[model samples]
Target: MPSDVSRSSARPGGSATDLAAVWAVFTDMYEAYLAGDRARIDAHLDPEATVWDSATPQLLLGKPALDQVRAQRPAAERAGGGPVEAGLTAYDQVIDVFGELAVCRHWLRIDYRDRPSGLLRNTAVLRRAHGGWLITHLHEDGQAAD
Candidate 1:
């Protein structure tokens, strides 16, 4: 909800705990995207962040690139409508935290427009910055749904 991520006691210690913490941040970022809250999304991303998605061949690097992509999208898609629904069901999630850096790998099921559009294999790299974890790099490959 807020730009800042909240930590819970339920998330305990060790890799699992760390993973949960990072996952919370990730979900928050995703929610911001869905809500079209550019400020909130910016808060969760590093200035040098890069992302690759199935729809694009060019790597999206930096906030300007992200903005351009968003501007190119249809207003309805950006604003959200038409029975649109998306979910990220992550499996085989692995998070490795080293000092201030963390890498997460997971298989994700992405449902779009109320249908199972695709399965995505994702790897995200985060860095502890600006008082919280911010996504620095994200790579995704979309595959045919089962």
Candidate 2:
């Protein structure tokens, strides 16, 4: 996490603190993606993590599947003749923490290749394990591009 980012007032075991931590993790994950640092992204994902993205019909299950997709990212980015610029901005975020589990819901605007790709509503479930927060499941619904 960036040292400059403001810390939430919520305590470690409290929902607010957990929510802030989740947001920090989310930010770090995307920053890693933008930098093409798959290892960093992988570090934040649980072994049995799953994801459903708007671009694919099949569900992504486990690290292997996720890694396969990430492996292709470089080739895909080459289409843009360099690193693809990507970012995720979240809104209407709601977070709930239950012990070591946390669920976050938010509306997101994702930009890819320097332009807005889509608006998505997402729910991500994370668990605190291996001494840090790791994403366990993610479900995303595609919305009309804005």
TM-score of each: 0.75, 0.76
Which candidate number maximizes lDDT?
A: 2
Task: Quote the positional error of residue 94 for candidate 1 in Å.
Answer: 0.8
Local distance difference test, candidate 1: 0.71
Error of 1 at 101 (Å): 0.9
Model 2 clash pairs are none
Cα lDDT computed for each candidate against the true fold: 0.71, 0.72
lDDT of 2 by residue, 12-100 (tens): 34565566778777778767866768788888888889989665677999988866775666664645564345666666666677788
* TM-score, predicted candidate 2 vs. hidden true structure: 0.76
Tens digits of per-residue lDDT for model 1 on 12-72? 2335556577776766766776666779878878888998966678899998897788788
- Evaluate model 2: give its lDDT: 0.72
